[model samples]
Target: MQPNKIKIKNYQLNSNLMLAPMAGITDTVLRSIVRSMDKDCLLVTEMLSSEALVNNPNAKILESNENESPLAFQLSGHKPHIMAKAAKIIENKADFIDINMGCPVKKVVCGGDGSALMKTPQLASDIVKAIKDHVNKPVTVKFRLGWTLDTKNFVEFGKLMEESGADAITLHARTRSQMYADKADWAEISKLVNEVKIPIYANGDITNIKNAIECLNLSKANGLAIGRGALGNPFLFKQLEHYFNTGEILPEQSLKEKIETLKEHLNCEIAHRGEENGIKFFRKFYPYYIKGIRGGGAYRGKLVTEDNYNNIINLLDEIIENEQKILHIHSAN
Candidate 1:
């Protein structure tokens, strides 16, 4: 059965599913696409450095659109003062402020932020408290299980966040040392659910509908936050929602549906970043969407060499046309 939708602060999410704030992946264009597919789910912006929010020319990247209501901004920093200032700047523009304590990147950890904050409970609490004091909207924290294997501290850390005035917490069930390598330890998340009164969202390797259901059941979390699962499959939100609401498994993606969705995603990226940089930015995603298909490697090779938007679009068109022909032949056989 679908779990009851819960309130964070003034905003009530219609579903328990959320989009995890991936660093380079979840931008305005991707959030808009996800919103179109499932309007009820909460979407988060990519993680912005608190320093960058204050000093960088790319501050506009953190701004939320009017159409993208119920959106949250994820900020990463080590200093409480900087986090507080950044939260104040975003409070007027975002529905909620999220502190990123889960990023395991070396650059982030070396700066005493991200997963490194996990090792410093007092500092993490201070950062959360500082942001809470500055923002009227709900304050959320996203963090990993611990800094490393020997220092798994999320249970105590979660209690500290609640004590510090965070409205909710999302636990990515992996230590900083694991770095997306090992399977996510949902058992630790279950411990967090048992310990904290605040809403706990479980995040990890939730790749599909079945995995999402299993994570919710195993972790007993209030909600599930999906990350890599939505890479080429924005439809995942709708699929999980439908299953949760009605106990029905949605049909798998048809070849035509896959092709159309990829095209739509490419168009959204192009519209947001413009032709030149958009195409460059999108090169990383080609392998993800076209993996395991015949001639996919060849198509990816051509995609990398092409700079002109027309050529890229033409290549995608040719690939899609050929894929359709192959599907037709298989169906006839």
Candidate 2:
């Protein structure tokens, strides 16, 4: 069943299916796209560096709008004061401020941020407390199971954050060492759920409504935070909402529907970033949108290399024309 309204202190979210803050993927443009599909799901901005927000103070990462309401700004940094400063900067703009402690990239961890913070509970605790002190917005933390298998300190780490005044927790159920190698350990989330009073969200590898249900059942979490799953499948949020409320699996989107949406996605990016840079950034999303089309492989290769927005629009026109031929013939059955 769908969860009722989830309240994070003063902020209330209608859907428990939260968007995970990805570094480059969940930019303002993508968030804007997700918002058009889902009015209730909580959205998260891409991970921002605390140092950048403090040094430049005009970083584009801080860009947002009320259209993506209940959005959270995720900050990554090691120092308590710098993180605190970054939190304060986005306090008025975001519904809540989320600290990222689960990023597994070597560059991020080596900087004593992301998952490396799991190894230093004291510092992680201080960073949370520091940010809480600087902002009136509810504070949240997204971290992994632990630094490594040998250092499985998630229960202890979660407790530390809870004591440090984190309003919510999102646990990606793998250690930093696990990275994306294996499946998320939902059982571990159960351990933290039992130990903390704050709203704990289960993240990592949750792709569908079934996965969300199983993860919630196993972890007993307040909600599920989806990241990679929502990349080209923003409809997953809507489908999940539908299934949770009715237990009916909605029909998969037709190829024509997907192609049209991809075209819309391209235009949205172009509008946000202009033709040149928008087309460049959008090249990565071709595979996600065109994955199942009959000639998707060759088209993906062609689309990614193309530079002009007009060419992209033409190619999309060609794809839609071909796809609709098969779609209409099949529907007539």
Candidate 3:
């Protein structure tokens, strides 16, 4: 069967695949890279609290450009007025505004935001209505299945958001009590799809093409949102697209390809944030790129400890060269 188009009212994405907005990953540069790979994937920004946006309109996190168009900005907060105000400020720059009610972090939930809002369904609805009224773009909501095991009221929660003026809803099919837990109950997603008229995107533990297929079959969701799975593997999107278009799963990227992408990622970071800060920023992603390679621990250690960008680049080259030869020797033996 052919894949369906991802539609959020008037705001339609080119594919039913999206990159879930992550705290430190989906910045302008990474989003730009993902965008260049897929001309129309739905890209989302890191969660910005209403308080953060209202307090500092010039904050670097809120910056964007045309390269990241069709991008959704996810806002997290409890108050209606504050979120409405923040929505107005970013309305012009975004393709859609997503209200984050899925984050299970204690710090965010303690502030009556994120997944905590799911506990106060009316309050969550109010914020959604307020932002919807304030912004011209379509307003979407991303939330979990429920607060806890016994309180799996996501069926009601999704309906409430749809009734409250949300154009679409993204459900991370896990209760707050089940944060990051591998046992994501995709079966619950079927409930929302059946009960709500709005579009539903499923997120959680979708690590590869196999999981994507199983989740889609179980949830029957309109789209899939991948988070940690995309880390150090941006090529996953291209692979996913190829599968969607042709039903063929691409092979895992080779070591050389992974290292090359890392180099490109480093260069992009350097160009975007400048040399010194860029090298520091790229440090966080080194482990993911070196994953599964022989002697990766030593290389990962070297990557994190090195301070100079030139040295870091040289080290990556050396690691790839030696690892390739080592694997060849192992194969011969």
Top of the candidates by lDDT: 3
Cα RMSDs, all models: 1.5, 1.5, 1.5
TM-score of each candidate structure, all chains considered together: 0.96, 0.96, 0.96
Candidate 2 per-residue C-alpha lDDT over 23-114 given as tens digits, one digit per residue, 9 for 90 to 100? 87998878877888778888999999999999977776677878998899999999999999888878889898999999999999999999
Would you give me the overall lDDT of model 1?
0.86
lDDT of 2: 0.87
Clashing pairs in 1: none
TM-score (C-alpha) between model 1 and the true structure: 0.96
- Give the count of colliding residue pairs in each prediction: 0, 0, 0
User: Where in model 1 is the C-alpha error above 4 Å?
Assistant: none
Of candidates 3 and 1, the better by lDDT: 3
Residues 176-243, candidate 1: write the lDDT tens digits. 99998989987679998998888888999998887887898899999999988888788888888888
lDDT of 3 by residue, 1-333 (tens): 446978898776779888898988888888887877777788999999899899998788887779888899999999999999999999889999999998999999999999999899999999988988888899999999899989988999999999999998888989998888768888789988999888899988888988988999999999898888888888888888889988888999888888898898889888888988888888899998888888889889999978888888898889878978988899999
CA displacement after TM-score superposition, residue 37 of candidate 2 (Å)? 1.2
Q: Which ten residues in a row have the lowest lDDT in candidate 1?
A: 56-65
